[model samples]
Target: MEYKWVVLTNTTLGVIMSSMNMYIVLISLPAIFRGLGINPFLPGEFVYLLWVLMGYSIVMATVLVTFGRISDMYGRARVYTWGFVVFTIASIFLSLIPSNSGNAGALLMILLRIVQAIGGGLLMVNSTALLTDAFPPSERGKALGLNQASFIVGSFLGLILGGMLVGYDWHMVFIVNVPFAVAGALWSVLKLRRTPGTGVVRLDLAGNVTLAAGLLAISLGLTYALMPYGNSQMGWTNPWVIASFPLGALMFVLFVLSERRAPAPLFNLSLFRVRPFSYGSIALFLNSLGRGAIMFLVVIWLQGIWLPLHGYPWESTPFWAGVYMIPMLVGTVIMAPVGGMLTDRYGARLFATLGMVIMALSLLALTILPYDFNLFEFELILFVSGLGGGLFSAPNTTAIMNSLRPQDRAAGNGMRQTFSSMGSTISMALFFSMLVTFFTMYVPNEISSAVASYGLPAQVASFLSSIPASGLLFAAFLGVDPASAIPQSVLSALPHSVVELLDSRTFLPSIIGPPFMDALRISLYISVALVLVGALFSWMRGGKFVYEESAGRPGEGRS
Candidate 1:
């Protein structure tokens, strides 16, 4: 194989490994908690869950720009090779953690995941830049398309693989990454050569600190807002959340100022001035924002409500949920490479715009579906949504890379990932808030009615009604039996028949389903609007444009 092929294969494998690790952890969370003997709903324990879920992405998003810049100043290949080593080490550590270790084990896993994120960030920053370096503008789209497709496919496989492996042992979820990482790392060391750094090597301390701190504060605040504060459904009013917003905003303001004055700026302002780069980035951000939450929401709906109602056991729903989501993966796999090929032949604007339109239409279709939707209809809509994502991701990425100078590609890709990572973070926060707000509003009535119908005491009914919707959501999301969420005292007081009725698989869904669907409808509507806006941005990015570097400026003579 050619050297470029070597790079592509190794980097693609890296994408597969890293992305697979991420989604496997996501789907395997219930198993992990079970193995650790941790109660996700316990006070302060939710924080651990949040950390496990979001910490890696948070760290990756926070440090990627700096790492990308460092790779530019040092050598992309060198940094990338080390990334594999670090990621593999982290995976091994995670897999080795003892089940009996309790909170210490959970904390260790989070810390190890942070280390893995650092590695993954390095891989992500350089992988596309390396491909851009290897391929010409005419073929860049296809190469990146294939790369993007691999990422999507990897994520999908993780869902299935998590189901399979976690059924045997939760540790297998992390353990699966080792062999692949080792193979990739060895290939990287043997086959990859260092590409020399461009210009002067300088690190911007002020810019780095401010950016990391700002993003961390903001992400933490958003994540914690899923918890209750006082009598409120969400902790948005909590002092910490309140204080984080202004503090994060102030830090970001300082970061911008520092970037403007720094001898070697962290982010290049001139890159944003380029029409395609700026608009393409914005479109990508919007697409990620619109699409991120919907993926998890679908999983939750399948695992928590739909599958259970259809006779799947609560503990078995995680695996089946992934199984049901296969259509989305299939659609992406089919479209991504084709979209890339088309973008290379034509321009990205039309294809990318059309993809977003399709996605919006799919969201609209989903909005009208009942909580227990027709399986075929649900799968069809999922396929369309996946197709749209596949169509947009690669071409948008290629366009962004094509519009940057060789030296700037690392930093440029970093900028792209930052937008994406931030989008995912914001999407989760937004989706959770939306779900909690509407569920809290309508679920009390639903619960009260159900309890009263079951002839439970008013005190028992009141207590159940007053329990925060967020807790119920977490319980469902974590695949806990709904009856398990009830206080033991309440369960003991209830008649045996009432207990059985309340504990039935369909009972929780009946209580929460209507409100969940109500919230989901609004969320889908918002997603439609967001993706349409994204399409508008994509259309405005103009024709296929490639940058050529000269005298430290890019795209100067290309047009």
Candidate 2:
């Protein structure tokens, strides 16, 4: 077999493993909490839940650029192999975590996940550079397409795979990654060559510190901003959350200044001068921002609303939600390679712009559906969105990679991944804030009225109405019954029929659906607008331009 094929296969495997880990724990969180003997909904425990969900991504975002620069200074293949080793070891520890260890177990899980994220960051920052190194310019689009397709497919598959594995035991979810990681590590070590670096060994200490600090602050703020503040549905007003953004921005400004002065900068800000690289990155950020939260929204839609309203039990909703999203996987699988191959022939600009346009239209289509939307309609819209993602991802990534000089590939790819990751983090915070805002406006009255009509006492109704929107959404997200949060004494005092109704799967969904959909429509509209702007930026990336050392600056002469 050819060396390029080996690179492709190994890199794809690494990406799949890394991407799957991101979502596997997400879907299996309920089971994980159960195994830990902790309630995620309890007052102090919510922080643990937030950390578990956001920690990996935050760590990945913070370190990607640093890892990328390190790969360039050392050797891409060597650093990448080390990533597999670290990830494999972390998976082993995660799987063996003692059950019923309570908060200690949850903290241990979070710490291990942070370690896993470090490995994932290494793989992500260098994989594209390695692929770009191995493949010819003409074939890079197809190579990257297949690699990126695995990433998206793996994330979706993780949802289903987690649901399946967690049914028997939550430990199985982490255990499943060990064999793959071990094989990948061994394969990487034996087959991959360590390409020589730029020979400039000095590290950019200032740049690294500033950039990492900035991203860390920003990520933490976004994560915590999803929590409720005093008398508010979200924590946007919290002094810590409020301070984090400007401080992060100030740190970023300092990072830029430090980079300009550094002997060896972590990020090559000059690369932004390349039109395709710059425009493609902006488009990528916008597209990611628009689509990142769709999975969470759709999952909540299925698990919290549609499935329950249609009589599926709450415990089964998480698994079935993954099953229903199969059409999206199919769409991505079919379109990603085709889009990449076609971009190689016709140039990335056309395909990428068209993809974002399709994305905007599909997102717009979703807004027209009622809360009790037709299943076929929902699936069809999701499939279309997936197709748009497939079409855009490979070509856009190919364009950005192709426009960079060989020496700059790792750092450039790292910078690109940073944008994508940060966009996703911010998107989750932004969309969730929007949802919670709408929930605050509508849910309290809806809950109070529903319970009142059920003949609950005024105090009971008041207490139910006062339940925080974030808690309710988290309950819905975890596929736990909302009534589980009620005090046992209160539940026992309620009439038998009312108690039955309160505990039933349909009750929360019935009242929550309308408010959720109202928020969802507004979010969809915002997504449409974001994607449309992304399409415009994609169009601005101009014609196909591949960098060559002799070709002068990137946009001067097309390869």
Candidate 3:
């Protein structure tokens, strides 16, 4: 087999494996919490849940650029192979976590996930640079398209795979990655070779420190702001949250100053001067921000409202939610490679722009959907959204990589990946904040009215209504019946009819559905606006331009 094909195969495996880990744990959270002996509804336990969900992303966002620059200095292939080793080892440890370790176990899981994220960051930053190096400009898009497809497909597949594996054993979720990771690590080590002309360079310690610190502080702030403050729905006014933003901003300013003075900067600030690189990156960030939380929102909608209303049992909603989302995957799989091939022949701007426009329209359509939506109509919108994502991902990526010189590829791609990762993290924070705010304002009354209508005593109604909205959100997210958290004493004293009503699949879903839909519409509207703005940026990326072909020619870099 040719070396380029070797590079493509290995990199695609690495990409898929890394991306799959991001969502595998997501769908398996209920089982994972059970195995850890943790109750997710407790205020203290909510911190653990947030960390589990966001820790990997936070680490990935902060470390991507640093790893990219390191790869540039060392060798992309060499560093990438090590990534496989680190990721595999982390998976092994994660699977070996003691059953029912409680808080200790959850903390251990979070730490190990951060380790895995470091490995994932390395793989993500270098994969595109490796593909770009192995393939010619003409073929780069197709190769990148396939590679990008693996990432999207892997993310979606993780949900399905996690659902399957967790049913048998929660350990199997992490264990499944073992064989794949071991094989990929060995394959990459033996087959991949470092590119010639690459040489070691000094690391920009100062720039790296400031950038990492800045990103960490900001991410930490965003994550914690989802928690309730003293009397507020969210922690926006918490002293720690309030302090983090300004500290992060100061660090970013310091990072910029350090980069300006450094002989070899961690990030090449001058790269932004290239229109395609800058604008394509902006579009990528906005597009990611728009779409990041949609899956989570959809899952909550399915598990918390839709499936229950349709009479599915609470315990089964998680898996079925994954099953129902298959249409979106189908749409993406059909369009990603085709979009890439066409972009190679024509240019990235049109497909990329059109893709975002379609996404915006799809999201706008989603905003009008009633909570009790037709399944077919919901599936159709999801499919269209997938199509838009498929069309946008590869071509947009190709444009960014194509705009960079060989030496700058790792750093450029690193910066690009950072934008994408950070956007996703920030999107979750923003959208969840919106949902929680709405929940606080409306859920108590809704719950009180619904339970009272069932002829429950006023004290009982008040007790149920006093349950924190955040706790209910987490209960819904985990596919657990929210009524399960009520004290056994309270349940024993209730009339059998009231007890039955509380346990019924329809009761909670009915009460929460209207408020949930109200919050969802607001989120969808923001998503639509974000995607439309992303479309504008995508259009601004201009005509086809490949950096290698125009390196020595004046005015050739501008497309």
- Shift of residue 217 alpha carbon in model 3, Å: 2.9
Model 1 error, position 552 (Å)? 6.7
Tens digits of lDDT, candidate 3, 1-559: 9988998999888877876776678777777887788865665365677677677877777778778877876788888878888888899999999989999999999999899888888888888999998998889889988887887777777878987877778888887777777878889888899654356677788987897788778767876776777876568789999999999999999998998999988778788888889999999999889888877788788877898889887556657777887787778878899888988899899999999998899889888889889999999999998899889988999988888888788888989988888788778766876787788789988877876677777766666565667767776666566567778887788788877777777877788889999999999999999999999999988899878654763224644
Model 2 alpha-carbon miss at residue 111, Å: 2.3
State the lDDT of candidate 2 residue by residue for 323-390, as single tens digits: 88778777877789989998888889999999899889888998889878899998998899889888
CA lDDT of every candidate: 0.81, 0.82, 0.82
**Candidate 3 local Cα displacement, residue 446, angstroms:** 0.7
Candidate 1 TM-score to native: 0.95
TM-score of 2: 0.94
User: In candidate 2, how many Å is residue 522 off?
Assistant: 1.9
TM-score of 3: 0.95
Clashing pairs in 3: none
What tens-digit string does per-residue lDDT give for candidate 1 at 402-499? 88888788998898898888777667766766787787788889888887787776766765665677666666666665556568887787778777
